[model samples]
Target: MPVRSPLYLLERFDPGVVQLDRELRVIAMNSLARRLLPVEDKQPFEKMVLSFHPERSVAKVKFLLDQAECPVSNPPPMTMIINIPERVLLIKVSKLSDLRGDTTGYTLIFYDITELVSGELPVQPMTPESLSIEKPAPAKRQLHKIPTVSQNRIVLVDVETVTYIRSEGHYTWVSTAQGSSFCNLNISDLAERLDGASFLRIHRSYLANLDFAEQILRDEGRVSLKLRGETTPLPVARTSVSRLLEQLGIGEVDAQRT
Candidate 1:
């Protein structure tokens, strides 16, 4: 087949295809490439398709292509993003060879895979009935009711009731001035429901209410938090010291004292 006919065929092809040379410079591109690429030049034959993907630079592409030339039964496909001003592209790369069996470079075919990953693709619209059909009815959130100090009533207490919360296996122990109570709630769930300003997670296993904290202590270079009515100091990890101080309205001045 003539070169012109092959070029014409490439133009009509659906997927965007760019042919590169040994130096990874674009030698030719199909009509689909013209539509996909942001290049202003009408003639796609001589245009060097520079590495559009920010993460996948020209150096990285060349390195991968070189690796692909090795004798392997099967090579894993490389997924890369093509950064265009108008849209983001998810690209799949395949090594290309010349007619003389020399490793010329690579061919990249890309499509917009952003919507699929981001869950933006509209399936069936969700209705109240449709949402409830697959699962049991969700229990109503009882935020208005305040639980008394007595343990007689079963109460759904807010995170604010507790001065400090500690994790025990699957359950969390919420401690207050009156007493401590166990709840079958994870630290993550409590963190989401808690008031950000009042409560702060100082450790992976513990969350403390800043309002109830009397003082924050640094014991021998290790940090610990002193909660109201609590005899034992709550362990504060070094990683959480900065965030914990910020939440308590204590800045550099307070940090230096501790």
Candidate 2:
């Protein structure tokens, strides 16, 4: 929710990159995106969709393309699975903001989750007792949880695979290595549902999984935490930096939030 550095964000979305105008014309594309383009239709993105499995998905794809032309009413990150020639790509669509902080277009970051679908890497379920945080004495009221991420459907998610939970206006987005989904609960409500040892709230808008905490980055006076499966760094609060580092088993060396 703070001013995020665009430079790092660009780095986060490495490999798959495609820039489009409001009308959905391909303005610029990286080498990876270029490679995926069909030989005959190198002109514009809207006219040329590479390949799709179910025919109905084509219409859904177009709706998302149109959603990116301007600022989105609810930006919780939309994800769709599309099949291209020989590969299955997981496209994560995020809103791209302009100088005035208005939504300009959308950015599509592609990830190949074919192997995962093929049963190579499986989604592990996380239990509250399996985490490694200090336990407080049992409370009078029993705290029950499903440890599941739900949008339209519900799937039990392991705490280890959870990357982060972010607040987007009234909704909280829960993202795992498997995928991301919108939760009906607010950030505070979602945080209480997660295991304390593994999940920590770094910012008022961000709760992170320590298991995925890869590195802590301090760039241009802003401190952020880089998770394993994500390209973007989740912003950390200046006041909670020390405590977060301790929870993640990271040493201190001038970590501050912008």
Candidate 3:
């Protein structure tokens, strides 16, 4: 994996606004947009909006722009959530027009929602094709590939590569070595769907894969498990600690001795 850019540390809550001419050329941008984007690294003026984005994101941005050209009067803004490096952005595009109804310009607005996602995980950019899976009727089957949402696109992650899963209200955030993505399935539903032999409910909000287990950390009587490729240790509930250790082939006595 490549080193994460320090720019990911910038405040994510602030809104970034950019203005584009009818030709889709960058006209202006707010201070926040300059900081949030690569405006300094790349020339902004006379550059097409697509040029400002990474090659992988260009198609999605173009789609958003295309969707904004609604024939009806007072069309709603086109919205999408996209991943860039270590950040997740919620973007909206609104079209502008002259008095005669001729297209004038556009306003592109975005918010960084990285905190709502997995902390410290670089969000992997997903393609539109990845998001186009047909929804089939629910059935009881072991999950080999889990579907996750990133940039309004669905990404299929292989189950073996997953490190952990965290509950977010009814939805779940699936974590892997690359990054985390939002999964529509609830934790309980996922627990039931996933292979019991591979995943364990270590806590009410956490499901851990024992294959990634690196070490069992005990601090002040509380137990936490450090997973491979993950920086933070997952809290192991008091009740689940022994089970987790046993699953790792570590007896309680052996764990205490270590």
- Top lDDT hit: 3
> What lDDT, from 0 to 1, does candidate 1 have?
0.57
What is candidate 3's lDDT per residue for 189-221, written digit by digit as tens?
A: 678767887799999999999888888888999
lDDT of 3 at 238: 97
TM-scores, all models, native as reference: 0.43, 0.41, 0.48
Residue-pair clashes per prediction, in order, are 0, 3, 2
Arrange candidates by TM-score, descending: 3, 1, 2
lDDT of 2 by residue, 84-178 (tens): 33334456566777677776766666654333333323322222342213455332211122233344223334445668988876456778777
The weakest ten consecutive residues by lDDT in model 1 span 141-150
lDDT of each: 0.57, 0.58, 0.76
Clashing pairs in 3: 81-151, 131-154
Please say which candidate is ahead in TM-score: 2 or 3.
3
- Model 2, which residues run further than 4 Å from truth? 1-151, 254-258
